[model samples]
Target: MEVFIRHQDKNKRKEEAVNFFIEHKTNSYISHSEIMSGRAKSTTEWSENFADILSAELDEDDCNLITIEDIHNKIIGIAILRIYRKYLIIEDMIVDGSLRGMSLGKKLMDFIHNFAAEQKIKALFLESGINNDKAHSFFEKNGFEKVSVTYIKTLSE
Candidate 1:
């Protein structure tokens, strides 16, 4: 199977890609009780807000959203990125569940690395959930280091 990666337009197709990512991301938390519990407490508002933010990010000059499509033009992966003055950040990445072991994530990361090098970016950064062991392993294998811990607190009004 041949796969091609390109910048995706902010359209219905992009929305589908976002939804696909959200589904997989959410499912990944089923084994992590704390995160899944928080997710289940949220209403549709969370998804709506996330979509708005993702759309806004796509409109920023320093941010990009790329879709990986199969030969038949079906979007099988999505990558969201932001390039800053000194570094590039991968905000989100997801591949079709069935294609996990096929090196698609490596392909996407390589694309980011090359693009950053072209832009003279000095470093790359990303945040993976603490409970996402699979993602952590993948990032480590791709040369990412565990630099910082992100702590979150839930506040209620």
Candidate 2:
């Protein structure tokens, strides 16, 4: 499979991107209560909520899209980025669950690094839950060091 990195129009690809993240959050969420308790919560972010946050913080020029398109023009993976306050953050990344172990994620990250380089970006940042070991490892292998930790405590049930 071949991955294509292009600037996807929000109006055109909103649903596809939404579905991808929603699936990621759902499929990869921490299932066991022992794990989801304490400081480790499931990485379950709804797509509509993400879309609202993105739309609020990012202008049209501040966002980008990367998709893995095969010969049939089907998207096997998707990655989103946001450039804000002189930092580039990988807002989300999700490959179709069935397409895992196929290196599509690598292709997507490569495209992201290349995009940053082209823009002469100095640094990049992303937030991944502890449950997402694969994603955290992927980012580390891609040269992202965890500079700080993001802490969250549930306030209500």
- Best-fitting candidate, scored by lDDT: 1
Worst 10 residues of 2 by lDDT: 31-40
**Once superposed on the true structure, which residue ranges of model 1 sit more than 4 Å away at CA?**
27-48
lDDT of 2 by residue, 1-157 (tens): 6556566676676666655655555535333331333222344533334545444433456667767766776667777787776678886677877878888888888888888888878788887655778877878888889897655565676
Clashing pairs for model 1 are none
Query: After superposition on all CA atoms, what RMSD does each candidate show versus the true structure?
Result: 4.6, 5.4
Candidate 2's TM-score reads 0.74
Model 1 alpha-carbon miss at residue 35, Å: 11
Residue pairs clashing in model 2 are none
lDDT of 1 by residue, 1-157 (tens): 6799887775556677766766666534322222333433332213335555555556677668888888988888888888777888887788887898898888888888888898899999887655678888999999999897755565795
User: Model 1's lDDT to the true fold?
Assistant: 0.71
Deviation in Å, model 1, residue 4 alpha carbon: 0.5
